[model samples]
Target: MSTLRPGRRFRTALRLAGIAAAFAAPPLAAGAVHFSRIAPLTGYAPAPAFDAPDIDVPFDPGKRTAVVVMSNTGTELTDFLAPYEVLAATGAFNVLAVAPEARITPLGAGLDIVPHLSFAGYDARIGADPDVLVVPFINDWRGAANRPVVAWIKAHAGPGTTLLTICGGAVTLAETGLLDGRRATTYWDFFAWVPRAYPAVQWVQGQRFVDDGNIVSSAGIANGIPATLHVVEKILGKAVALETARKVGYAPVAQLADPRFTLGMSPLPAVLLANAFRFDKTEMGVVLHDGVGEIDLAAVLDTYPRSGTTLTRLVADTRRVVRSRHGLFLVPRWDFASAPRLDRVVVPGARGALDDAPLAAWARDRHGVGVTYLRGDLGAPLAADRFPFDLTLADLARGESAAVARWSARGLEYTPEDPAVLAGAGWPIGIVVWPMALGLLGVALGTLGVRAVRTRA
Candidate 1:
């Protein structure tokens, strides 16, 4: 064998290093982009004001109307559903889900939803000012596409409507200038950015929800339950609110906010980075049917996808839209016959034995996939003083990886009831190790090929 010259050896080594770096850079860059998308570390530009002509909508004499506003592009899953379900369950108000357009609205990390009324539809049909107008976090809140939504909100900002903004929906509400000189709270992730974006609004930290008379704002996703219940108590009475809370299996807290939620440097960033960079992921199918519990569905759809190991799809027997228990319209993505082969099937809601058996059988017989339930006979009961999100976390810990469960909790800024479930969970070693191993192998192969070419020359 002819030994290489010193210059040739040095050049070969440089080529190998370059090959390794080329193999590694794409994934690293992509992971960083993915992480930034989820947790925005950058500053936000101020929201622009959209001038909307005031439309005098007459108030209905019969019952107070509540409209949960939806955007055609995307809305946060839990923020939209939890409040809608809780309010509808009380049966004290005429709760309606309205969208900017009549088209299907995609929810962030969940199924597509069809709102009951479009802005035009609501104007033509109800022709009444909503007593409560709920603004959920939408994907394109600051973009030009959201001008119509901003204008509609601004027009309805009179003293007659109670404006409730859930999570980052506070940003949207702030766009309407309603929260100016009002105490408001939002998702903890926004603490750094939103205040700078809207300095006119007094932003409160460590609060689950804030009520400055007509304008109300909730801290984050799961907190929507307690905040909405608080609204129920304000409108109906403590008795009705308590009953509604009991029905939903939620225990109300006396404190204005939980001090546990805040942002800082922690293992969460590393964990998020690992999950985002993970190459091997499972495709999970979620069954959508009529009368599915909105909270249950939201919990599964929101939690599993965040784990970074699972991709969720809304599957149904038919392609038609189905109504949730509280009346949020859900449009299924795939019919069972046409759906891609899935690693597993998730059945959400606390549907009783009669409803669950068919789903389990179909998942088993037709697809040969195992079924996981969000609640009821097959699934664990909601723990005492726990929300549906906690149930989802527990399921993630048990069914998937403990590390993934912790990641989901960290993403939501939620503290789990049992620390034991997430104990010892850390960054996925495979995410780092596998990529390094493959990169080394690629470099070695490239070096061998280069040497062979030199020998032939």
Candidate 2:
């Protein structure tokens, strides 16, 4: 199915404002009470739900055209893999991951990879020029390790070799003087920053890419997929680009023409959740749930579909695949270390508390700045000491959902285990269960009466 359009995007933005207004009670008096006086995020308001991307296009390896992806120690996985996977699936290109060193290179998150070609190794071993050179976003644009790779691009990649860059990878290519004084684009989060970094290059906004004949640059990590689709069209044909996009369940957008890259990045301090886990929502909603065990988040993902604030799942470890309580596996967008800075975090409750020390450390470090959500035992130490909110889990669970509103400003969403364990659950399932229980009792009684009459006869 297609994604939500601009109108719904606007409505969701407004709905988020409404949720924030609902939760923020009483005027903030000058010097009387601070904004911190508000309770910790208790629970989330409801939102339109959406299914995570599940298109599994089969890989077909045929054409041996050389496609080399340049990387360093801290390459963003999505920026590299999204385009690499798209190109590899076409069976048209031979993809190789090349780094600066011969040894195994550690990547973002906890993942590691062995390079197919090192800067010097490629020249001595393969010795042949590749048709396409892909540069992924790295942790730092001006890292010392990237000097060799930049030199390689400068020497070989020009006019004949199609050099494609994802997000901040443009900076790497720009260092070669290739993109200098040429139209280019980078990740939206750094839309302004990139231009400031290299004023010589004309950084274009409101578009997915700036394809200046031989070079191609994309907006962000997720936007890389669309940018690569444009490349597929350039190499293979329009038919292939459309076919690849269709098989992958993504519509092929026009080249050099995606305006969405500009609008969302202006807002900072957005909420960032680890992207993973399948939820039972209909449309892509605002609030997110990152499952730690075999736990179902159907009830929890219900809140904040239209929540205007940002919500994403961040992988805390090397693992991108997350298995839910029902064996639902999902790949998240961001990992812990590389995730964008945001206001607060929401951790869903599971059957057992996971030993995620890194998350605890991050929370402890940002105790005053951001709210750290811990469902059940997960929040024990953090909440007990720095329980800055006027409300508690117990309070929200017992009282009406309105009490949870205090924490809903940043699109707070949660699913507590055993809602009945509390005085009463504020969700729909908690309130609707009473009538269903009475109906079941009446049905049993009626059946028993009929059996007794039959026995008498």
Number of the top candidate by lDDT? Answer: 1
lDDT of 2 by residue, 1-457 (tens): 7498989988988866644443332221211232222111111111112233342212224444444455554566556655665676666776666667644443333233445556776677555566778887765557786777778877767456787888778888888888887888886557657777788999888676778887888776556667788888888887888776654435435532443433312111111110111111112111123443211121122122212122333344433445432222333344555454544454544223355465556645743233234344322433322211212333333432332322231122121222332233334343234334444555556557657989999
Off by over 4 Å in 2: 1-68, 252-262, 265-457
Model 1's lDDT to the true fold? 0.73
State the lDDT of candidate 1 residue by residue for 1-457, as single tens digits: 7499989999989877779776676556666766555432111211112222222333345778999997876788889989998888888677888888766667755477767778998888887778889998887898887888998888866578888889889999999888888899998878888888999999998777888888888888877777888788778888888888877767544432332345433456445545556655667788888888788787787777767666777888877767788666677777888787777887775446136677777788877876776664222544423566777787677655576677777666566545653544445677777556655666677668778999999
Task: Tally clashing residue pairs in candidate 1.
Answer: 0
Whole-model lDDT per candidate = 0.73, 0.49
Q: Candidate 2's C-alpha lDDT?
A: 0.49
Model 2 is weakest, by summed lDDT over 10 consecutive residues, at 269-278
RMSD of 2: 21.5
State, as a TM-score between 0 and 1, how close model 2 is to the true structure: 0.48
